[model samples]
Target: TAAAPPRIFPQAQHFVSKEFCQTEFGIVYPPVISVSSGELIEVETRDCFDGKIHPPPNENDNNEYNPAQALQQMKRAEFNPITGPIHVNGAAPGDILAVTLLDIRPKGVGVT
Candidate 1:
């Protein structure tokens, strides 16, 4: 008989949903959560353009893509909205952090 498959379990200790994304990084903003090293955390992120430029809803529309128009659409204080404010335990200013991507499943049909 074949061995049973390994059961998959979610490892994330904390979850930061897409609603947590912000346009600016500031020390004044309280962290959504604090985490220690070797811990698993999951964060939902918004696109660089904050979903304003992507998903040309109607492909059949005659309107052509305009970079200028896209820029205008972004009325954000920061050019890129980031999904963070994660407080790393023991981490301080000037300390460099390294990230290892275990898995990444990107959604939608956009290309770099």
Candidate 2:
């Protein structure tokens, strides 16, 4: 069966890279993008290895893939490169916000 076309959110504030990724949560790291409450947003994320893990170089060379290599080369003391600083409007410290998933599409080239 054929796949559906990617969903587009014309009103969504899109974030499609790891440029704003942070290892730890701190005040010094400001929000990369901010939007009002109930606003749609899109965030593309990297793998937990910070993109160190990868598919084999060739179709026949599956053994070439190694997770330990990626882990050793990671920069953060923690796992998963968290990308966000989305400041939601009207969301105060004491208030709780909820998120709804409209759709999730896997893009090209996932780590094997």
lDDT winner:
1
In TM-score terms, which candidate is top?
A: 1
lDDT of 2 at 65: 60
Lowest summed lDDT over 10 consecutive residues: which window, candidate 2?
1-10
Error (Å) of candidate 2 at residue 73 is 4.0
List the candidate 1 regions with Cα displacement exceeding 4 Å.
1-9, 59-70, 76-78
For model 2, state the Cα shift of residue 34 in Å.
1.6
Listed per model in order, the count of residue pairs whose N, CA or C atoms clash below 3 Å is 0, 0
lDDT by residue for model 1 over 5-73, one digit each (tens)?
A: 232326667777666777887997789888998787777777777766664447788968765677687
Model 2 stretches with alpha carbons more than 4 Å out: 1-8, 11-16, 59-65, 75-78, 107-112
Worst 10 residues of 1 by lDDT: 1-10
Provide the overall lDDT of each model, using Cα atoms, as 2-decimal numbers.
0.72, 0.68
RMSD of each: 7.8, 5.8
Which tens-of-lDDT digit does each residue in 7-75 have in candidate 2?
366566664455578777777888888778767777766666666666647767656665667656766
